[model samples]
Target: MSTRTAELLASIALIVFSLGLMWTVHTDGLKIGWVPERGPGSGVWPFWLSLGMALTSLWTLVRWFRRTTPESRNEAPYIESDRFGLVAISFIALTAMIFLVAIVGTYISIALFLGFYMRFVGKHSWPMTSATVLGAVISIYFLFEWQLSKYLPKGLPMFEDGFLWLDNFRWEYFM
Candidate 1:
């Protein structure tokens, strides 16, 4: 609960992360050697960078054990209970948004995300959230699909789908 505990936990996490990075670099064929005629291989930079991170985290771990720093002297709690809930909610929302994007199109996913964020987090009224979502969807549809003629991910067989080649539809042709 104290700052010292938080620092130690973070250091441990960093150590684990650095180990994973080292494993990835090794698996990816990190070649630290430079060719005679050419420059270093792709893995050279990553190999050294990961090595540095690993060493730094190890140092941090040592520092935590020593508790010699001013930050360690202060025993303030790292994360308050109230703020943790907000962080958890935001993270869950992001995961749900990804799932929604895969099931629905990007347009609908963004609209839903904005609606949730506005109504719940921002404490906006339903009408304001709805209008904002609608306006955003329309802007995205026009800017990316209509004007730029780009193909974005579409969901469903009907209205929920984006990038419907509606850009190709000419008013003159209809006339």
Candidate 2:
């Protein structure tokens, strides 16, 4: 499809999606305003965010109709032939990562994804790729598991046992 057609379709889709999200939030009965003790209700952020998205989408639609935006005026193909390979590879990698999350756990899947993306797609040095992968894993582990006390998915039983061992080690040495 042409860029102009893609832009128009995306804008309309966003508008519909935003409206649906807003309706869902309203129907859930979560107050969109401030509560008695709490500063803001649970639905306040989502409702306002959806409203903003809808407004922005409407603006984009208007611009598209007027052919004001560059994308709206451009008739070029959305994905060029040469660039399609990269896009396909990236999509496949993302899909693989998501699928691996259910089999190897979040941390392992994320590490693999980062490693593959950085080393292959980004063409970064091995040291740089390894450091980035390690940093991301450590940061996520500390932020969610250590600080927030929220345990992420551990995948299969073997992976769960491994994570439990790591948790025990962390508690024993760090805590």
Tell me, by lDDT, which candidate is best: 2
Q: What local lDDT does model 1 show for residue 114?
A: 87
Model 1 per-residue lDDT at 66? 85
Q: What is the Cα-based TM-score of model 2?
A: 0.60
Off by over 4 Å in 2: 7-73
Clashes of each: 0, 0
Candidate 1 regions with alpha-carbon error over 4 angstroms = 34-42, 69-71, 156-175
RMSD of each candidate? 3.3, 5.8
Q: What is the lDDT of every predicted structure here?
A: 0.79, 0.97
- Cand. 1 Cα-lDDT: 0.79
Q: What tens digits encode model 1's per-residue C-alpha lDDT throughout 67-131? A: 77665666876767778888888889989888877678778788889899999998999999999
TM-scores, all models, native as reference: 0.76, 0.60
Q: Please report the candidate that would top TM-score against the real structure.
A: 1
